[model samples]
Target: MPGHELRYDVNCSILFTELPLLERPAAARAAGFDAVEFWWPFAEAVPPASQVEAFLAALSDADVQLVGLNFFAGDMPGGDRGVVSWPTRSAEFRENVELVAMIGAATGCRSFNALYGNRIPDIHPGTQEETAVANLAFAASAVARIGGTVLVEAVSGPQPYPLRTATDAVAVLDQLLVERDIRNLAFLADLYHLTVNGDDVPKVLTEYADRIGHVQIADAPGRHQPGTGEIDLDGQLGQLERAGYRGWVGLEYLPSGPSAESFDWLPRHRRGGGADQTNEGDG
Candidate 1:
C-alpha cells in the first residue's frame, strides 16, 4: 500500500519470461500493466531493424509506454558479464549507441541502465575504467539530446563488477559528469542487488534520493516477489516517498508463481497505467 502513491512499471525481461518477447507486452496488458521496461530486447547488441520494429510495434499494440531499457549486457543467461567497460568490447558498445538512443527517442524512454563490464585477467583497472567513462559519456550525450538520463547501477556479483556499492556508482557518475560535462548521468538504485551486497537500505534511500535517476526492486535472497523474502519493501517504499522521490518505481522482481499472482501484494487499481487500469481490468 505504501508504494501505491508511486507509479509502477513491470520489467518484462524478467517478469513475463513465460511469454515470448513479442507477446510479453500484451501479456502484461492482460495482467494489468501498461508501462513496462526491459533489458536490451535481443541477445545481439544490434538486433536487426525488423526485430527492433516488431518490438516497438508490440509496445504500441499493447499500448504500454516504454519506461526503461538496458544497453546490451551480452548473453545474460549464458553467463556473459556486461561489455560496456571491456576493452575488447568497446567497439561493440559503440555500435549500439544510436540504435538504443533511437528507441528512447521513439518510445519516450528516459532511463537507460549501462551495466559495468566484468574484469578480465591482467587487464588494468585504469584502462577499463577509462573506457567505461568514455563509453558512458557517449550514452549520456545521446540520451541528453532527447532530455533523458543514463543510469549506472551497482550490480552484486563476483569481483567482475568494480561498482559494488552506491558510492562506487555515484563516484563514476561524478567523475564522468565533471570530465565530460555530461549532466544526464545518474544512479539506478536497485534495492535487491544493493541488499544482496549488504548495503544499509535505509541509509541508501535517504542519502541518495536526489541523485537517483530510477529505482528497481525485488525481494532479496531469492529475488522473488516482494513478500516472499526478508526485505522490508513496504517500509522501504514508504521511506522512498518520504525522501521525496517522485520518479517511477520499477517492479523488477521474478515471480515465484505466475506473474499475475505477483500483484497480490499491490492493489488491482494501482497496477496498470493509471487511467487504463479500469478498462483493462474490465476487459
Candidate 2:
C-alpha cells in the first residue's frame, strides 16, 4: 500500500543530475512526479538573465510545481556545504535572499531552505551564530512578502556544521521566531541527517513535527534511495503524517543507479503525488 498521507517530490539537484539542469523538471514529470524542489539553481548568488529565464521556462514547460528551494549553499560539491552563517559571506547571502525571494515568488514556491554554514577557520562560533540568525531573519521577512516560509535544515557530514541534530535546527528556528517575531521561520526535519548524527527520529518527530516546515529523506550509511539502506523511511513518514505534517517530503538522496530506476521503492502510482502525469507537457 503506497502512502497517500504525504506528497513526495524529488530533489532535482541530487536525483536528476544525470540530466541537464533544464532537463530535470521534465524528467521528474515523466517519472510521474507533478512537483519538484532544488538547491539554489545558480553557481553564484546572481547569474545571467538568460540562465534564470531558461530555468523558469524549463519548469513552465514541464508543468511541475516548484514546491521548495534553497537560498544558496556555497560550492556544495567542493565541500563548502553552506555559507549563511559565515560572517564574511554575509553580503553574498543577503544578495542571494533577494534573488531567492524573486525566484520563489515567480514559481509560487512555498518554502525556502537556508543551510547553516560549517565551522571555518578564523570564524568564531559566536559570530557565525549571530550572522546566521540575522540573515535568516532578513530571509523570513523577504520571503514573507510572497507567502513563503523560511526553513533551517540539520546537516551531517565530515564538516562541522552547527546544526548536526534536529534539536539544534529547531533551536535556531525558535530563536529566529523570537528575534524576528515571525511565524514563517521553521525547522526542516531531515530523517537521514538526524539518523546519521545518532539522533532518534521518532522522538524528534514526536516532539517537533508541528514546528517543522519541511521533511527530507535519504537512507543513512549511504545517502542513497530510501529502501537501499536500513532506515525505515515508510515508518518515519508515517510519523510525520500522524503528526499532521502535510507538507512535501523531499527525496533528497543520491541514486545508486539511474535516477528513473530509483523510484521502484516509491512506485509510479505513488510518484505523481495524488495525480497522474496528465499535465506532463503543459509546462
Candidate 3:
C-alpha cells in the first residue's frame, strides 16, 4: 500500500559506461523511479550531440525523465562551470559558461549544478564570496537565455568552499535573487553536505526551503548510500515535506555495489511503463 506521505521522484545518475546508457531507463524504472541525473560525459564517450540524443531517446523509450546534468569541468567560453574564484583561472572559467549553455540546449536540461570548489586560505572570505556572486550572476543570465537555470551545490568538507555554510549559501542566493531579479536561479541541498557541514537539517530546510530547487542524498563520510550514514533519512524527508518542497529528490549517491542492490533500501512500488520521452538534464 502506498503510504500517505508524499513521495518525490528518485533519480540516479546514468553514466555507467560499463553499462549501456540504453539500459539505464529500464533499470531506473524497474527500481520504481521516474527520473535520473548525471555529470557531463568526457570527450571519449559519445560526441556531445550524439550523447544528448541517445539519452533523449532512452528516456522516450523507457518512460523516464532526465532531471539534471552537471556542466563540463573547468571553463569554456559561454559555459558556466560556475566557480569564478578558483585560483587565477580566468580563460578556463569563461569556457565553462559557454559549454554549459550548449549542453543545456542539446539535452533540454534546465538546471546546472555549479560547485563552489575548494577554498583558498590566503584569499579573504568576503572577496571570494563576492567573486562567486559575480560569476554566478553572469552564468545565470547565460543559462536563462537558453531556458535553463544555473544552480550551486552547498559543499561541505574539511576544506569547504565560500558557499560551504548554509548561511553563506542563503546569503549569496538572496543576493543573486535580488541582483538578478530572476526566479530560475536556485540552490542544491545535498544531505551529505548538510550533515557534514553541521547544519540542522530541518531548520535549514525550513529557512531556505523556497530557494531550494534540487536535493541530493548520500551517506556522510563515504558519500555512499543513505542507510550507511548517521543522517536520518526518513526524518529529513519529512522535513522536505513540511517545507513544501514539491520537486524531484535525486538519489545522487554512489552505490555500495551494483545500482540494483541499492533498490532494496527504497520502498517497494509498482513499475509501470509510459512512452513520453522527456530528456532534461539537471544536477
Candidate 4:
C-alpha cells in the first residue's frame, strides 16, 4: 500500500478482455473503480454512429468517468502501432482526431494518447518524422479545444517503434513546444514499456515528472498485475507522487488470473483513492 495515496483508474481495454467490449466499463465499476481508460475501442478509425452511441452509452450506464483514451492506432492486433507517422495515413489519422475530440467532448475525458507509429521500410525516416510532427500538432490543437493534453508514449516491442524511451518521447514534446509553441502536449510515462525498453524508471520519474501527462503501469518481465512481476511499482509510484504527479495511475496490465481476481494487490478503497470511505470488501 505504499502508493495507495495515488488515484487509480482501470484500463478496461486490457483488464476486462474476458467480457465483451461494451461490458468492460460496468465490470470496472463493479470491481470498485470509478474511472477507466482504454485504447481505440473500434475496428476502424470512425465506427458507425450507432456503434459510437452504444460505446458512449456503455460508459454512461456504468457511471464511470473516462480519464484517458488513445487516438485510433491502426490494427493493433495486426501489429500496427499508429498511423500518425505513416505519410499515406495522414488523412485517416486526422479524421480520427476529429472523432476522438468529439468523444472527449461527450465523455469529459481529457487525456489523449497518440502512439507514434513504427518505421516504414520503404519511406525515408525524415519523411516519417515530419508526418508525425504535423499529425501531433494537429492532435494537440484539436484536443486543446476540450482542455485536453495529448500524450506521447514510448512503446516497447520488436516492430521498430521510434519512441522507445522517456527521452525519446519527450524530445518530440520539446520539439512541439519550441517550434509550434504547443503547450498541451506531454509524455505518457508507461512504466512497463519503459522498463521493458531498459529505461531507468527512477531516473525518468525524477527527471521528467513535470512533463508526464499521464501514467500507466504493469509489472515488468511479463505485463501482469503489479505483485506478479519484477518492477517495484510502488516505489516508482511513490517517487512519482513525491515529484508531484497527481494524475490518474492507469492499471494497464494484463490480468494474471480472472480479471476480477487479479486486483487482490489493490484494495477496493485504495483503487478509487477513497481510503476513508468504506467499501463492502476488496474486489
Leading candidate by TM-score: 4
- The digit string of per-residue lDDT tens for model 1 on 34-150 reads 788999889799988999999999999999988888998887876665787888888788788788899988987878889887777789999999989989988888877877788
Worst 10 residues of 2 by lDDT: 274-283
Clashes of each: 0, 3, 23, 0
Write out the backbone clash pairs for model 4. none
Question: What is the lDDT ranking, best to worst?
Answer: 4, 2, 1, 3
Candidate 3 differs from the real structure by a C-alpha RMSD in angstroms, to one decimal, of 5.0
Instruction: Give the best candidate by lDDT.
Output: 4
lDDT of 4 by residue, 33-144 (tens): 8888999999999889999899999999988888889999998998999999999999999999999999999988888999999999999999998999999999999988
- Model 1 regions more than 4 Å off: 274-283
Every candidate's CA RMSD: 4.2, 3.8, 5.0, 4.2
Better of 1 and 3 by lDDT: 1
User: Considering summed lDDT, which 10 consecutive residues are worst modelled in model 3?
Assistant: 272-281
TM-score per prediction, in order, is: 0.94, 0.94, 0.76, 0.95
